[model samples]
Target: MSIAKRLASQTAIYGVSSIVGRVLNTLLVPVYTARFAAAEYGIVTGLYAYVAFLNVVFTYGMETTYFRFANRPDTDRRELYSRVMTLLLLSSALLTTVLALLARPLMSLLSLPPGHERYALWIALILGLDAVAAIPFARLRLENKARKFAAIRLANILLNVGLNLFFIVFCPDVLAGKYLAGLRPLVEGLYDPTIGVGYVFISNLAASAFTLLLLGRELLDFRPQLTLAPLRPLLQYAYPIMLMGLAGMVNETLDRILLPRWLPEGFYPGKSNLAAVGIYGACYKISILMSLVIQAFKYAAEPFFFGQSNDKNSPRTFALVLKWFTLCCAMLFVGVSVNVELVARVFLQRPEYLEGLAVVPVLLLANLFLGVYWNLSVWFKLTDKTYYGTYIGFAGAVLTVALNFLLIPLLGYMGSALATLACYFLMAALCWWLGERHFPVPYPVARLLAWLALAVGVVALSWWLPVAEGWPRYGLQALLTLGFVGLVGVVEGRRLRTI
Candidate 1:
């Protein structure tokens, strides 16, 4: 089979898990926003932002490191897996214990409410289970078990969503005497209305635990050997990658963490810190369409790239993938940006949470740049210059912090969104320039930029159009989206026919 076909197939399978899972996850946004006040939902958003950072810390780049060494000619795949698994298991256990013990202090440091220290415990357990399961999930990707990967992933999502519904919806009905009287006591015991967003965390923890159960075979398959021979090389490779992951998370999520705290004390006198956070967080999900696409591509691309590293035409292949990725991401950006109000209403569904709708376009464009940056990032990974990734990520993180700190106070979450856009645009440009100097991939920069330009132009035209909100506006946007697609097909069609 062709490399492109393989990657496409892998992407499709991964997309089933990522796209479906995230779409379902996104659906919960309305549920969350509807049930909790902006401030309450903000707590959920802030905690999860910390969760993203902690997840990176727990896994410590082992998944990528596993891919790096597993492809080496001299490495024993089984031993490497065992060593990596051993290292993660020990560290995850120790980290979980330490964090659980320090849960109260950590909660205080994070400026969470007075009595919610257990949030720390739940987050710690969730991250620990997920970290330990990381290698197993990556193993599925490495072995080309995409269907199994999707199945396990979807199962986890289904379980989590199911539990969330039961706790948040069904149990409440029962407790309120809207259902089974006999089960009222049990439902009352399980469902605490005051817990609010805590139910979301508990649901997630349950799902993570369930995923570990599903991955039992992968977990048990690895030997308990922890020798220094393989350990040294893996850690050496992973350390910088971990730093990169840390910085990347900072770039990705630190804004959500910082926004509430960074906003002026009386910025929203009527609202709590979480209220602004909740608003920014909800609007941020508006860009998940692009984010999920990038995530699915990354899931499939990482293993595919490593597997094809030794191929003679790998550079050309990477170039083609990058071009196509940019094209798709550009289309997504225009699609979401043009249909922003409809998308916002569908996902968020609450007027209050929609205050940050203006950030959607900025963030959509930011994620587009981010997707391109991910494509460019493969260069450093391929060249074993992983430290370059560390440098770029840290630089982006610095920009993120500085810009967000400056902007949030001035413009609220809009400033945060702009900061994100600036960080990613700079990162993508820097990576492209550096990639040319080190591992030239002949990225179709002009063609890619042309597509992006056209996408942005169409979106701009749609926005500036005087069509009133309703079917007329949607119809106009749809026509513009279709026009862009047709234009791409016409341009790329001629080139493909010649090939």
Candidate 2:
């Protein structure tokens, strides 16, 4: 089969787990928005932002390191796997311990309720379980065990969703005498309304633990290594990646983290700073339509690129991947942006949450640039110049921080959205420039930009059109979205067919 076909197939398999599972997970947005006030949901948003950062710390870059070393001709795959797992296991335990110990301080730092230190503890456990499982999941990717990887991921998401529904929805309903009144005793044993948003973290912790258990076979042959000598080379390669991951998280999530803290009181009339965060966070879910594609592609592309690193035609193959990736994401950008109101209403159950809907398009485009950056980043990875990724990541993170600081007080969450877009665009552009110098890929930059521009133009036209709400607006959006897709087909049909 062709490389394009293989990547697409792998992406589809991964997407089933990522895209499908996230769609299931995204169901919780409406539930959460419906059940909790903006201030309450903000806690979920804020804590998870910290989780993104800590996850980078916990896993540290060993997954990619494992892939790199495992692919080396001189390396023993099993020993390498064992070493990676050993390091991850030990580090995750240490980090979890430290996090648990500092849970109270973290609660204060994160501005959580005074007594909710258990949230930090639950997050610590979740991170440790997930960090330890990283290599096993990466191994599945490396071995082309996409089905098993998807199965495990899907199981985790399903279980998380089930537990969330049980605790957040069903248990509460039973207690309220909505139904199943006799089961109130059983429900009472499981659910506490006072626990409230903490259940989100608990559900995730349970799912992560369940996932580690399901990965038992992958863990069976693990041999612990206390000394760092054998892992020096891997660590040397991985630490830079971990740094990049840290900076990347800052770029990706620090806006959410900083928005509430930095914004002035009464920035949005009646809304509090945390309420702005809740709005931004809920609206941010709309962009996951783009991120879902990016994530699945990343899962497949990382291993695919590494395995194909030596192929003479790999650059052209990489270029094609970016082209198709951009095309698909551009379509998504246009589709989601044009129908932002509909999408917002579906996921955000309150009128206040809709205030940030304007940020959705900016974020979708930002995520598209992010996907492009991921494709461009394959160059540094394949060349083992991963430190360049670190540099670019920090540059973007610095820009993100500076931009958020400058803009949040002025524009509120909209400032955060703009900062994200600018940051990702810079990262993608910088990566492409650097990749050209070190390891050039024949990326179709002009054509890709044209498609992006067209997508943006279509969305703008949708906004400018004096169409009334309801089926007319939606019908117009449908036509415009179709029109963009059709134009891409006309322009790229022959090229796509050749691929």
Best by TM-score: 2
lDDT of 1: 0.88
Model 1 residue 351 distance off true place after TM-score fit, in angstroms: 1.0
Q: What would the per-residue lDDT of candidate 2 be over residues 1-499, giving only the tens digit for each residue?
A: 9888999999999998999998999889999999889988999999999999999999888888999988899998888888888888888899999999999988886676688988999999999999989999999999999999999999999999999999988999999999999999888887778899999999999999999899999988777765678878989999999999999999999999899889999988998888888989998988988898888889999999999988999998888888888888888888889888778778989888887888988999999999999989999999999999999999999999999999999898989999999999999999999999999889989978887887888988988889888898899898988898898889889988998
User: Model 1, stretches more than 4 Å misplaced?
Assistant: 179-182, 496-499
Model 1, residue 387: displacement in angstroms?
0.4
Distance from true location, Cα of 299 in model 1, Å = 1.3
Per residue, candidate 1 scores C-alpha lDDT tens digits across 1-499 of 7778889899999999999888898888888877778888888888889888888899998999999999989988988889889999999999999989988887776577678988999999999999999999999999999999999999999988888888888888787788788998787777788887788999999999999999999999988977777588778888899999889889889999888779987786677777889988888887878899999999999999888889999899899898888887887888788888788778786788877888888889999999999889888998899999989998999999999989989998889999999999888998999999998898989878877877878888888999787898899888988888887778887865543
Positional deviation of 60 in candidate 2, in angstroms? 1.0
The lDDT for every candidate, in the order shown, is 0.88, 0.91
